[model samples]
Target: MLAAVALAFDMTSVLALMYPGRERVEILGQDGVTYVYACKPGPAGETPAAQAAKAQAAFEENATKFGEAFAAELMQGIEAGAPTLGMALDMTRKTDGWAGAITAHLEKTYGCALLG
Candidate 1:
């Protein structure tokens, strides 16, 4: 589940850093890590973590878009040997691996994701 946790951070960072006017942006690489978060003090002068505080607000405002984007990612393989961790994470959180509020909130959230 550590992989899932790492991927989750990268996923949220990738989405939060998306340029508002971008027509298209590449979030994750073939290695399953998001390139956006890997860069240091990027062209925009803001680190990915610098924007994390507003992520929940952004998602709340664009819930539909967020959900769609998330579903799209779920259809693709994010890690080697793990076609997708959606089911695994879901099951794990329900079983002995539950991690408390964070997992619970994520499981209850409803939103759509936009690729662009």
Candidate 2:
């Protein structure tokens, strides 16, 4: 029984190593905007360190795009001035509702479970 358990564990680890899936990284910008980036796994022949470096490069490249969009939106909002209480409440409600919609979209699009 012990041998069987060990073998099962070994098989699982080997499979994970063989097909180590893409990585998801979430970055919170200095301006309080959050971005999620997905990096594809490296080709089979690449060393683990090289794979990590590639992923990091991809992340940095993608972060520029995300940051620009977020900054533009934030600047637009700031230029619009403060909102009324009702407007604030309405915006809050809409953002809250969007959480569920975004989660569903991600699951449907990517076929992956989301952790809150």
Candidate 3:
């Protein structure tokens, strides 16, 4: 199924991103799903602030595309069922809910009380 393929791809991508020196980070969403990723070290001579900025930039770049793709896949799954239009609309509203959950998890894990 497409969902299975997507999950497989996600797992493989996570594994491919991992390296010996990379930091292993696990973020548990309120939805009960856990996202695992390996954060790579910043480039040589880069300041901590610069590294954080770069990480944020990279996260935003990939998150948008991944979110869109996931939304489309979820819509496809809904369409395959006999859901009503109202149900579809409700589901669409939650397309970006995962982002909030992830952000919460990250903030809590990193002790970033000021994260928005």
Candidate 4:
């Protein structure tokens, strides 16, 4: 249920971020999920306010795209591995092994942090 909701939000973000005339983008994963964030390099004389606004727009756009793709990809993987991974995580949590392993897995694999 929670995963579904999160996935929806991510998808929505992606739609919102898909803007025209944007460039210089890269994607990354933090904990266990992939993400897309935008970065731009330009003239040095741009004012702070303008730079902030540009960065904010770019970041938001990148975030939206990243979230949508991440959710879609996650759903595909979860469909394939949920039964085993879910069980493992639950049992590991009960045994205090879930934290490090899960966090590390997400960080190394997806670059997304466990929200929680």
Candidate 5:
């Protein structure tokens, strides 16, 4: 029975790798495990490390509900300072009831609204 189970698992792994059009979603975690959140768009050129950092920094800055692990990874992304990652982190920071802060910052810094 154990042998059969192992064989089944092996076959499933092989099939998963062989299948075409498999969507690979990257989950940024802490200690390389425990997902905090998932970002779908703007992942093409961004590394997992970068995304993790961004998420962490935003979490810290906004004191959002994101868990500790996620916040750490996001900090790494913020450190990298990649354009897409920065935008994503900023957007997330703007959320979590920080819209007022974001709007004021945008207006004060750029002379316009964050959305307008």
Candidate 6:
């Protein structure tokens, strides 16, 4: 995704998207592979990443949630201030309630309200 139009969040070396012009956040977790949270308008208001993921089969074996076609777009759409891979190394470790913990961290740390 383009750096000027997206927000990236992550936990445990995993990166997630809260793309620009979209009303939802997709938070992938190492604990169970993926943890998604979408806001109002639901599917109709999905981000490019979310739409791309839905375009493919759910949980395609040996393939990413978003197939190869979306890889480049996703890569290019990241916001300029989005966290880098290096930051993940120093990010919070996995906990029992990883989803909640990471969500809290994202909102509190980045001031980006995932739920809003």
What's the number of clashes in each of the models? 12, 0, 0, 15, 16, 6
What's the lDDT for all of these models? 0.38, 0.46, 0.50, 0.44, 0.43, 0.40
lDDT (Cα, tens digit) per residue for candidate 6, span 13-63: 232244334344455543354534332232455454554344222323213
Model 2: residues >4 Å from true position, as ranges? 1-41, 82-116
- Candidate 6 has its poorest 10 consecutive residues by lDDT at 54-63
> What would the per-residue lDDT of candidate 3 be over residues 77-99, giving only the tens digit for each residue?
77788466766675666655766
Tens-digit per-residue lDDT, 10-109, candidate 5: 3333443543333223334444543232222233556434444455445345434534545665677667775775667665764544657644543343
TM-score, each model?
Answer: 0.20, 0.37, 0.37, 0.35, 0.24, 0.20
List the pairs of residues colliding in candidate 6: 1-74, 1-76, 1-77, 1-78, 2-76, 2-77
Name the better of 1 and 4 by lDDT.
4
**Cα lDDT of model 2 by residue, 49-109, tens digit:** 3444443444445546655855665566667864656555755665566556654544443
Q: Give the TM-score of candidate 2.
A: 0.37
Error of 6 at 101 (Å): 8.2
lDDT top scorer? 3
The collision pairs in model 2 are none
RMSD for each of the candidates: 16.4, 11.8, 12.3, 14.4, 16.9, 17.9
The better candidate by lDDT, 2 or 4, is 2
Q: What digit string (tens of lDDT, one per residue) describes model 4 on residues 4-89?
A: 44443455345325432223233333344433322222356544334334444444455566558656756775777767567556
TM-score of candidate 5 versus the correct structure, residues matched by position: 0.24
